[model samples]
Target: MKHLNTFNNTILYDFMELFHSLPYTFLGMEKSKDAFESAKVVLLPVPYDGTQYPYKGAANGARAIIEASRHIETFDDELNLELEDLGIYTLDELEISLESALETIKRVQEAVEEILDNKKMPIILGGEHSISLGAVRAINAKMENVSVLQLDAHADLRNEFKGCKYAHTCVMRRINEISHYVGVGIRSMSKEEKEFIEENELDIYGTNFNSNEILEKLKDKVYITIDLDVFDPSIIPSVGNPEPQGLFWIEILELLKKIAQEKEIIGFDIVELSPNSNKISDIYAAKLICKILSFSFFSKF
Candidate 1:
């Protein structure tokens, strides 16, 4: 009995060591199950928060989201299918330098181009909303006409913020220069941003309207970016920037389902989650990813 106990303990030690050595992956899945070549979706994690201030923990978001994803059930009851069967490849986190935001975006753009070239749909997990700029730039290079659909609490249409044109607060402003955009769930914005929207007659579907109105304005190919702060603080309180009277879970999901049915969703990012001690935000972010992926891949609408 003593000899058997010793052998079991040795085996457990070896197993734990091997587990610790494995590369981190979304859903904690083995590489063999989700190989890059076979995958339909590729997850690019950009764990950078170079420009965020006050609440600055978004850099940890990618790691937290991936870690929490490991525990979710793979089967989707709404879709009535195992969405995991559609292979999801989680790449190593993008190594971005904090000193140069320009260089970081350039790196991200190049990486996204490579992912597209490989014919995989890219799902970016961001360090901040600014990261979407590079990914959107990459998408624009491949397709001649593309539109961006942003679901966020803030307009993000500032020309510049805090002396930096490339700050997260100005992400949509930068994107508007790249391609046309439609802003949804926006409850906050600066006076300048509001002026830009009104002057240009930009299509903004705010809390006052249902998301279905978004379908008419979007182009055939759309890149969707969701700032997690778009949700009410009650549901997800860990975001760097929180606004009151934001969209709830069901409302957002219903909108996404409609969009998936109506247009081709080329790529997307879920950003601005700053994990707390409870880790509930991380799990919510992960589930959001899974649900969106399932709907995008399998839904008729």
Candidate 2:
């Protein structure tokens, strides 16, 4: 009996070591049986931040988020559920095209289309906000009556920026051409974007807007695009363009829960997480993703 106990302990240690050494997955959980086929949610990491200018480290955001995710506990105390049960599968980081921003976006669109075809929900970890354009395009192609819910500090309504239509600043402009969108948490924008918003009579809500009013503007099917800069810089200062006076943690979570109950979240992306020396920002972003997933899919569980 003593020999058997020693052998079992040795095996357990080996198994734990192997698990920890494996390639990082979201929440550091073991893959489920037939991970891709059985997974209700798939994480598509696009580590291409070619369009980001002025601040350029956002290309490293996706990997940082994945690495930080390994440290998070899988159990959600608030929801009283295990997040690992959701079968979240993380795909290899997408190979980015250095040729041009448009080519990269095209690749993103193709990747997202395949995920949608498989009947899996895609949670894209973006290199920058521009990647959301591809995911939105893919979603719009397959589903009708889709509206984009953008949570960001910038309106991103510019027709072009730095001679690139697909630049991170112009992502929502490209998306607006494809589908209707509503912007929230907007406290920064150029005069061009402001004029465009007025000219188009767009639905953009600022920091003080009512959540219920915003909900009324959304359609039955929603594709959410979250730029980490939407959060207050004091809470998450590791974004490409951190702005002051942003949304707090609880407020964002509460709104997400309300949306989860009210509408269908087709897919979502969390972008512009330029990781710095602050490890807390990385962990916070990882936790935010898990919480959003928990709220989005809590009904299925």
lDDT value, candidate 1, whole model: 0.87
- lDDT per residue for candidate 2 within 84-152, as digits (tens), equals 788888988998898788888888899899999999998899899999999998998889988899999
For each candidate in turn, the TM-score is: 0.91, 0.92
Runs in model 1 lying further than 4 Å from the true structure: 1-23, 32-34, 299-301
The RMSD (Cα, Å) of candidate 1 is 4.2
Per-candidate total of colliding backbone pairs:
0, 0
Q: Write the per-residue lDDT of candidate 1 for residues 11-90, one digit (tens) a residue.
A: 99998987764447887655764377788889999998999977798998999999888877878998886756787899
Clashing pairs in 1: none
Cα TM-score of candidate 1: 0.91
lDDT of each: 0.87, 0.89
Superposition error at 81 for model 2 (Å):
1.5
